[model samples]
Target: MPKVTFVQMDGAEHAVKVAAGTTVLEAAKANDLPMVGTCGGSMVCATCHVKICAADRARLPPPTEDEEDTLDLAFGVTADSRLGCQIELTDALEGIRIQLTSTM
Candidate 1:
């Protein structure tokens, strides 16, 4: 299992443990976190936008070109921005932390 921490824009945080191979959006949804996956984990929507926190940003795999394109439509795009639906959980991401922007 891997633990993911989601920090809301208001500074509230929710941590959830999920199985490997889960998407960040799925984990968030399963735990009732505020992330909104409007496209249901498809790469087509930017509603699942989240910022990879500085501490865990480097641990994630680089985003694909499509993901980058979708992110461009997301509000509050930042250097660390990522669409949660596109991020799959892995053993290496055990303690990943993400910050929810005000976009949603």
Candidate 2:
């Protein structure tokens, strides 16, 4: 299991042990975090937008073309912005920290 940290828009952080193969959005939903995976990990909705911490950015695979296109419609697209639904948990993602964007 990977111990991942999700930082809420309010600057609060929650850490959880996530099983391998789980998407970041799944972990957030399971932990009651604020990510709204409206499109259910289909890369259609940008509701699960998040900013990957600089330190963990390189640990993830680059977003797909569809994900990148969807992110362009997101609220706060940054250099590290990514859709949580597209980030799969793996051994390499242990201790990964991502901040929830203000989608409201």
Candidate 3:
């Protein structure tokens, strides 16, 4: 399993362990974190937007074109922004940090 930490707007940290290959959005949902996957991880919506921590961003591959387009619809998008559903967990991603963002 890989551990992921979700940082809240208030700087609260919620750490959860998930199986490798589980998407970030799925990890959040399974742990009861406040994340929305309106399109059910189908890559059709940006409700699962999250920001990868600057230092950990290198652990992930670049977002796909479709993911980039959908992420444009999320509020507070940043240079490190990514749709949670598009990020699959891996042993290499253990201890990754992701910041929650608004669905709108």
Backbone Cα, N, C clashes tallied per candidate: 0, 0, 0
Lowest summed lDDT across 10 adjacent residues in model 3 is found at 95-104
The Cα error of candidate 1 at residue 9, in Å, is 1.5
Q: Would you list the C-alpha lDDT of every candidate in the order shown? A: 0.86, 0.90, 0.89
The predictions' CA RMSDs to the true structure, in order, are: 1.2, 0.8, 0.9
Tens digit of lDDT per residue, candidate 3, span 1-104?
99889998789999888999999989999988889898999988789999987789887998899998998788888998999999999999999999998675
Give each model a TM-score: 0.92, 0.96, 0.95
Model 1 per-residue lDDT tens digits across residues 8-58? 889998888899999988888888878778889787879999899666878
Q: Worst ten-residue run, lDDT, model 2?
A: 53-62
Error of 3 at 44 (Å): 1.5
Show model 1 residue runs off by greater than 4 Å: none
Q: Give the residue spans of candidate 3 off by over 4 A.
A: none
What is the overall TM-score of model 1 with all chains considered together? 0.92
Clashes of 1: 0
TM-score leaderboard ranking: 2, 3, 1
